[model samples]
Target: MICNVFTQSIKRKYLVLAFVLVCGLTIMVSYYKPISHRYMFLPDTQVANLNFYDQNVISGFVFGKGTPMAVSCPLLLSGNKQEMLVAQSFKRTTRIPSFYYSYLAKNCSLFKSRRNYITSSLTLEEEQFPIAYSMVVYKDVEQVERLLRSIYRPQNIYCVHLDNKSEPEFRETLTEITNCFQNVFVSKESLDVRWGTMSVLEADLICMHELWKYKSWKYFINLTGQEFPLKTNAEIVGILKNLNGKNNIRKSVLNRWATRWEKAGKAPAGIIPVKGDLQIAVNREFVDYVLHNKTAKKFLKWCSKTKVPDETFFVSLHYNKHLKIGGSYTDDQGNSTDPPYITRFKTWEGTAKPCHGKYVRRVCVYGVGDLPLLINRKELFVNKLHLDFEPLALDCLEETLYNVTRNEYFQTLEGNGPPKHT
Candidate 1:
């Protein structure tokens, strides 16, 4: 009787194991429901849906160039709904480079958990204002990734915009790069990063608008990816703290603050320049005023009718409306002492209003590349510097970080934080 009982028990165990194995296989297949499995990563023929995420994969966002960014915005969402491989499955099947986060982790402390920043003396808490970077990636994306790795701390976030005209392969690569950021974001309009004139300011507004909407960051700075720092982060905090101690930043902002005058029944054509766009330092109050002001919002609404009305639009408003409040100072150049505000770099030589008149495209070199030449616009917070200036800016060191341009970085206290992890 004991032998018979043992034999029966062993048979039951085998049956139970077989049932469990079958159920496990069913669940695995459900999670990985095969959708046109292609053993390719990031297809060039068309950007396909990534199949493996617990989340739904949508159209790929691109980065384009110029002030208004004619091409970038259209690329925001894709209409391509072709049958494709899952991003996870494709990645597993394809032989691409193994992934890692050396840039966002070691370089910028963008993610929430890693918010420590190091500078000469700026303590993290003392640095009252927030900073934002406006970056556009074109070719040399690998170099761009390296630039992101070297600069921008977590305290400051990067708003990256790509041009739409870039190759599909490059676009897919960029998508992978920015996915690592909690703080870093891809812009809505993917303009041509290299060609468009409006791309510069367009990127600025995008960053400012989104940062204002999402994060509590008080200041908005427009920094390019290629140009590294000229000053230590700590010195920046000190400068901003000192500025706040003296000025009323709320009444000031960087925009063309021109109000519409009732002249001969024409539309509101009046305009003036703001102070922050002067390539200097900024405080929280100023950023809030321009980005959140009811009057400014109305002004923007009015200006929308003007044909590509970006140039001098913000400037006219900022300088004219706020001038009475003792907020902004102007510089005509060829005059000795630096204006109350300072700009870090020289602008591309051309009349800003080319669309209304005859304007020629210009080549820019910030470092070794033939990038579009641009001044570190004090206005628009930070504008694209000619890439030729990157190494120079890197060498200058202190100037890039803390000096007061017209309307840029803020001041604060010294920092005691962890050294970067290489």
Candidate 2:
């Protein structure tokens, strides 16, 4: 009887140990899963195994069209009014903190596994001709990370300039994330970027200086944290190749305040100050000229004393034929009308189609309703997505891009053809 009692006690102990092990696993799973996944409507099992390259998984859940279509579609894309309301009610409950990135950095393989960062050049053209990006970011670390991930290509180089006034945690998280990539780095010199100020131009200059070290890059594109790409890397390379050597700098009619530069005597003599967008896609030669040319240096220095120097500096250099900056537009284009450029697509308040998303500071913060238009835009990138206001907008855009990229990559591998560049 004593022997039988001992045997029963052993079985009881084994059951208790098994229960503890199961509880431990549940806790670990909850703790390790990213907060972003919690907002996804997919079942935990499907989301846990989600893979962009898996055709079976992507065709169903990723594209939002499969069995149980209502649940499969991203909440924002659902036609049901109730689902739309549910998405509207969903808010980012927590900021992705520094520790999260720190953990990822420690486990680099796990970091790469969690997100679909294209680690290889998908095409020969992309590998042969790499692009450089300058990102000036201040707030919204999560948005910054997502933007980086969406545009990330191993062949490309990235220089991120963080605002000096940003939170320490923001800096820490960015540093950790950038540390994972060889080509990506945070600018050593941080500036306090303010709107309508020379600091904006200065931030880009700092990145340009650093990016100049990467001799292999063919073109330089400046971006902000809120923007996301509309084209894949291969598509972007094809477009840049078509440009041959010309720059894509938007030139607009001079602002009424242009006289202020002349009044202050800050304008270089005989050099006309013009207004244009801060975002630009200039060739390596243009970037080199801006970094080292004596005339460009003088123009930039003079611009410092003027209001909103960013709106004038690059455009002025490109328009002034006398400067002879490589890849610049020699003709006086922006004296009367805004010249067209395909570098970025932004919806300003009171212009073009009505903003489906709400306006903040006169810029449209894109919502899910804007996805159709965004997908159709030919611009390389689209500007200003607010994670808090409409996270699904970004989520859907990102998923679509991922699927497109995967399909293009596989098609090329099958000897079909290169990605079609519009």
Candidate 3:
């Protein structure tokens, strides 16, 4: 009877072991199972991961009917010691600026020192294209200063448009900051920018007109104060050179919602209305035509009466055949073809929403976990970075873009054969 009991106990042990192994296998399979399969194309995302799917297939697996296929997965970062340090620095800077700006304003030398510390670390590259930038900013003075530092190059020019509605202290701080940099200037004509109004377009138009005075800039890129450059100025110069005079603008269909301007009797005939975001990069010739051409002026006037002229003005200018500049690459449908759309990376409302960061007013505020994704992206600039939401994101970008150690990282990628320039 004792022997029988021992055999039964041994059998029970084996049964328990088998059950644990089966449970482990089940858990592993569940972890990796395809959560969902859906079409994705993140035109505004930092990385355009569209190479995986073909535009001709219908299976949506090995084949798909899309220009590019992008399947997004969850992204999360493990907070390391260094990342925490950067986060701490961001907190300190954001807090102290508000409290100390009054005293700093009275003391010029101290103010200069603080400004120098941020700008001095950046090293501009040689043989770089003279890029022109117009950044429209309202609040977030500290954030804008950080962005300027990251993208500052002696060769390029910057036009900053501070909203006329901004507080006096914000205006004073921006003036003091720009006073130190010769290439940087505060737009003399500051517009009171509003959502869904022509004023937004007017602010950019004012900057473009100002930037046009200097004939040296090769390409005109627009920015809001929240954007930061992912690629160095040197890398961007290489991209523009290869483009050979092509512009990067996002194109979209103008449906009923887009036709609001037309319904309101703001759109004009002989001008085909297209839709795109205000963020874009255009050549000097394009800028001149938009500012001076009679046709463009009439279109502008009509658009000013529209709901959101910013979206219509540039798209119309780009596709307008009357301009006689065949700069825009049109598809078979006669729309702008796979334009590089690289001036700024953004996350909009859709299936591929950013799972790794917080969203404010329906826009993703990128964080450190999103760094790997941003770095891998082909775009030169990424936008809407608020220090309050994700300080480490900007901090890591500074460390990677400006720090000496980054040279090695760049060298390796180049040595391994850098991806074709965007």
Q: Which portions of model 2 miss their true places by more than 4 Å?
A: 1-96, 259-262, 333-339
Clashing pairs in 3: none
lDDT string for model 2 (1-422, tens) is 99999999999999999999789767866766544442324455543443332334324423234422223234445445566665555664434545555556655677765544678887887899999999999888778987898788899999999999999988887888898899999999999999988899999999999999889999999999889998877888888888878888987753675664764474663677888889999998899889998878888888887878898899888877787777888765546232358899999898877678899999999887777678778889998898888676776777777767778887888999786664
Model 1 ranges off by over 4 Å: 1-122, 125-129, 188-200, 245-281, 301-308, 322-339, 347-422
Assess candidate 3 and give its TM-score to the true structure: 0.70
The backbone clash count of each candidate, in order, is: 98, 0, 0
Give TM-scores for every candidate, taking all chains together and pairing residue i with residue i: 0.47, 0.81, 0.70
Residue-by-residue lDDT tens digits, candidate 3, 5-60? 99999999999999997987678456543322221122433122212211111112
TM-score between model 2 and native: 0.81
> Using alpha carbons, what is the TM-score of model 1?
0.47
- Scored by CA lDDT, what does every candidate get? 0.40, 0.78, 0.66
Q: Which has the greatest TM-score? A: 2
Report the lDDT tens digits of candidate 1 across residue range 146-201.
35643445566677777677667556656666665666778876755432244544
The predicted structure with the larger lDDT, 2 or 3, is 2
Model 3 spans with C-alpha error above 4 angstroms? 1-128, 264-266, 330-338, 404-422
Q: How many clashes would you count in candidate 2?
A: 0
